[model samples]
Target chain A: MTEKAIEISNLKKTYSGGVEALKGISFDVEKGDFIALLGPNGAGKSTTIGIICSLVNKTSGEVRVFGHSIDKELEAAKRCIGLVPQEFNFSQFETCKQIVVTQAGYYGVPRVIANERAEIWLKKLSLWDKRDTPARMLSGGMKRRLMIARALMHEPKMLILDEPTAGVDIEIRRSMWEFLTELNEAGTTVVLTTHYLEEAEQLCRNITIINHGEIVENTSMKDLISRLDMETFVLDVDRVPDSLPDMKEVSFRKRDEATIEIDVPKEFALNQVFHKLSDKNINVLSMRNKSNRLEELFVRLTEKA
Target chain B: MFSKESLIALQSIFIKEVTRYFRIWVQTLLPPAITMSLYFVIFGQLIGSRVGQMGGVSYMEYITPGIIMMSVITNSYSNVVSSFFSAKFQRSIEEMLVSPVPTLYILLGYIFGGVSRGLLTGIIVTLVASQFVDLEVHHWGILFFVVILTSMLFATGGLVNAIFAKKFDDISIVPTFILTPLTYLGGVFYSIQLLPEFWQTVSLANPILYMVNAFRYGFLGFSDIDIVHALILLSVFILSLFSLAYYLLTKGIGIRS
Candidate 1:
């Protein structure tokens, strides 16, 4: 089996005012695994990433990357990991090419090699067209892409992206997701944190949801979605009934004289509800699922927690 | 966890910072030169015509080294303070904090950057001051030693200020309320010999006074206090400030959060 790309165990972090940011959290990422960390606001996602990247000092725990302890062999471990933060943090005066090349130099890449790698990554991210422009002059989406190019210049085996698509438009967000998917497919271990549950659902095979500084769920996406059996279907009918069917496994709401919304568990087949409506002589006009499997799973899990 | 690669990272950051300040030489290097020239014209030329000699040297020549040292101190301290604090404010310092580069390298990188600008501005001011007065250096070795050491000491001081500074205003508070006052009282314009006996004793406690006098002694071959003691005191201050700055950086104080 391939080695574990990252192993974090019993991590705990307490700020100065006794605020517990991470309370004994633990997880592992296998080589080439694409995992999404889903969480709400103030859920310690940033803290976890910060500790792994050695930006924030952990109160207690062990983090290992590529079988090397971060505390003991920080440089060796860090050399293999690249982090793209949520905010724009590059020097305002530096051009996109300069930012990437300088970051490569920090990892000991020779200047010529760094330049080559920077060019390749910038081109891959579609940022080569603006290579000479100062980073501060770039649009928000371009700056985000520039950050990703900079992070990739070192050719790290593992990449951690915190909200890589936040604040981006739909078209740009989709392109970024596609680009990251390609990167992961090319054998890089990817760890992502994002507020968009749909993005996580579409990209990640495995997921860990953090809330209140603790991991509420860590499992395969299939398993998590399967566990949330609730699904909703909105139906348009020819007419409204004076009273709805009293099915224990399903709930229905009348949208208007001709539309109704029904929520039912997966085990209770939709065919049964349709059969009941047919028996009542009500014609079903149209139907659609109100939420995707992943949305249902996320809402159920977070609400219960 | 020092490595060849980490040193390369330090050098990259140092070079970037040096390029940043020098790229805007009109703002970073010109202002000091102009300010020092005003001092030479006002104090050395206008005021010195009536004050005559100080410490057995012409008044213009007596204050030349002190003014140059003052410029070096201010520039060195401000360079790091402003640059580092701006990095903190912009949240770009996280780039270095997250990298494998050690904290010592980051500190040294900033210190070297500050020292470069400080020394460069000092040289320019010195050249400018020479046009106003016939300056003579009695000991080039002492002069060079004092200039470099004093620049380093203040550069380290700037790092400390940057680490503790929480806001943009915090950066100015020290240079204005503390550094400027200590510098003026440190005998940049007049020899400590002219102060009252009690004030002279109190002036001995100010570290900048030693730096100014040591630098002045290098040029004039005379000092109100022992130059050897001044050198030792300045060395101790540099070591202490360096240690404090390094400790704060490694602990991830202010920069990490």
Candidate 2:
């Protein structure tokens, strides 16, 4: 089997009236990897997804899924992938079971097998009890799950979810993360686009950030975080301090009597800060980033673009 | 003519199209039957009673086949137009477009769906019309062929209209402005032979007239035009309309990005 689940080269899309949505972007997703494609609105993330799914035509490019060219072998390429769009696209009047089974049929799954897969996916997604309910009757979170279940009916090797948890509650979002994690563990390659940076940091091993219709960054999550120039952390101390410890490589200040905040540069280790603070007789109970570190980095990179 | 994926995709779309109208039986199936019944009662019973014999048959009997053909055309055309346009409106068309299904199946599925509805409504109208008068079929095969071909022709027209439709109003424009006018002038209520020589020539230009006359001939055992020639023209028209629809869909006239 090819290690590449998806590969795109020089993908370009110039919509009618000369609106350039995707400006010759290219990337790849290795098999079994959980990846995040992050970007702000109008960054061409959905356009890229649309091109891969054959919903949008590319002016000039090559896209392949598991070594099958989308143009020459679209059915074969599409059969290998599933897309959960940002919006609900299934018929509202259809029952949850009907939606999934119909989706399975589109992939040419046998009716009997479609039925079995419908049951299995619905059960796995905790939607079995609502199988007979019309899709419109499902809550926001349940509808998202229904889309996921429908997408998985064919058991494609790769699944792409665009903002899967946008309107979902935190609890349902966490459960979806767990579900996606389990799917990844089962050897499915997952490419997710989400506004929740915490989601990307928690669930994805690799990240690709697009900005202004181009690939701004494509690296492992760890490597991207390591490249951050600085991170601010807050220290919770055991006792109040009249003055904070002086540190040349770090900027420190007492946010409150018993708490202090510090800006730690990439080259300056937390241990060095701790070492210097301990020398000053300040005992730190717990320390954490003042804000979401990844969020800070994402904001900076996107704004810079 | 299709691969396995294409077949499955066609079946899925066909089933969905079938389910949509059936689910709303009162709205989709009931209106045509009721409308045609009123037509049968008024034109076939009350007004048709005083109108006397038309073409050697009673007025009501003369128009029965024409009315049934009209119902089939209106229903089949409306079913695909409304259904396909609704899919576009709700963005559910993306479900199939984004899938591995071939685009031709999407077209066929909706086409068959409209044909089914049109044919079903034709049956209902035929049964309803039979209540007022005994409909003796001079040729059953011709009746079936003409009705099916007419339904398919208009269904293809509806698909074409839908691909160009941007709003709800766009969907209604063709059926109201173009289709209804054509059907009314197609000799549904009266024979075009009764018209003056010049007006008769104008009526001959209407494509619907051949369909109505051909269908009426199937039931009355005679027609104003040659049955064989009319069948060929109808077939050609159906093929041309289908080709245009297929072309528009492939070009992504309205549904693609």
Candidate 3:
């Protein structure tokens, strides 16, 4: 019975050209919940964020944040919601510190407090040394970090990040995810949209998958993963095998001369496969799960849709 | 908390925009100064010597105020049009739109930014004009009032343009076709008194004519038309345009798509 930070009841949006972006979507995000919105391109992910942020006018339905309706008490709702848009949307002429501080000001935070918060976020993002550089002069990764810092300036109760780490290097992406996870743990409700399923699997506890502007699935990550009956295991061998076990329940693919990818259902026993390998005198080099629970669930759900 | 907080947000946007234009003084401030100086040399000195006095004052003095007002109008209009349109193009406006900032505040922030540039350019052009003519300020209050109102009017117009503009070409169309013709015909080079009777009445319909005459009245305490009527007309234009701009902003016209 935790308090809901964001509640959308049958929210819908339709453009003037008769293109429906959201078709009666309803969901609730409880306080401190880390939810990931997974969807293919043009799956109404951006449209949903746009409506909640009040950047797009809703054709019908309602969105409320912290009990304030976005259409009625928009300022109050917006004050509590921080949106990190997918694209870089900052003035190139302004410095990183200026960008974050200005956004804080827009939310009515005092200049001193804004500057202090900007400093803290910049340091946390490892961008403190580049604070004075104009945003255009920063690398693509730095600009993305600056966008995150700017969104965090107001100390919002709920944060929505749209594709936060797309196009970033792997190391920076992992660090960003860590920072976001820490932020969520510190009591901010986070709703994220990302194309990277692995990142979503690692970070989110609640998951919602949208397809063609409709919420195809909305459930806990554990429940979603459990719904998928399939699992994959990668087995490493010392040498190439001339023939593989012809098991009907498992599918295998060669990964070079020393490895094979095996897909198995959850009901199947892995011990039988291992016994079969040992009987053939194929030494097992290593074995690892090819897909995490979330990945398996996502593949199953998206493919089914 | 609400009023004070909103005021602070408005002030922040205004300050940022002011800083943006001032940071590039060489490009924003200097060009108007140089352009006005050339107007003085060619129209006031070269053309005025042969033409003699206009409205019982030296041609240099008569043309000086109009030239200054012209710079103010163009600068104010261009500043808002180009800046806001560029923000739209870059999608940077999403930052403000997504924040808790009010729509009126966003509109005012951009309008004030343009007003600041227009007033600054007008002041610089006036100073440059002084080097060419012995200017006399008959009514400082009138000069200040007219310049401010004129700047606000054009700044609002610029915002309207920016709201409707979808691309770079949209920014140049009005300035080139409408603004240029209106300013040139609005008694910048010649007095409306010099025009034929039918043309005089036709020129009166141009809103820029009223602004130019009102500003001219401010400097010399004289005008071809009734100065009070001109002031009233300019006020009406400002109020109407402001209302229109505010409505467009609140409706999210051309901004929220």
Best by DockQ: 3
lDDT for A301 (candidate 2): 89
Give the Å shift of residue B33 in candidate 1: 1.6
Q: Lowest lDDT 10-mer window, candidate 1 chain A?
A: A291-300
lDDT of 3: 0.88
TM-score for the second chain in candidate 1? Answer: 0.97
Indicate the fraction of true inter-chain contacts that candidate 3 also forms. Answer: 0.77
Clashes of 2: 0
Model 1's alpha-carbon lDDT is: 0.89
Interface Cα root-mean-square deviation for all models: 1.4, 1.3, 1.0
TM-score per model over all chains: 0.93, 0.95, 0.98
Is candidate 1 or 2 superior in TM-score? 2
Residues A1-305 of candidate 1 have per-residue lDDT tens digits of 77999899999999888999999999999999999998888989999999999888899999999998988999889988988999988888888988888888788787789889988999988999999998889999998999899888889999999999999899999999999999999999999999888888899999999988899999988888778767888898999898877687889789899998888987887888988788777889999977567766777778887
Off by over 4 Å in 2: A237-246, A253-259, A267-285
DockQ numbers for every candidate? Answer: 0.61, 0.70, 0.80
Off by over 4 Å in 3: none
Using lDDT, rank the candidates from best to worst: 2, 1, 3
TM-score ranking from best candidate downward: 3, 2, 1
Off by over 4 Å in 1: A234-261, A267-288
Q: Evaluated on chain B only, what are the TM-scores of all the candidate structures, in order?
A: 0.97, 0.97, 0.97
Give candidate 1's error at residue A135 in angstroms.
Answer: 2.6
Query: CAPRI band of model 3?
Result: high
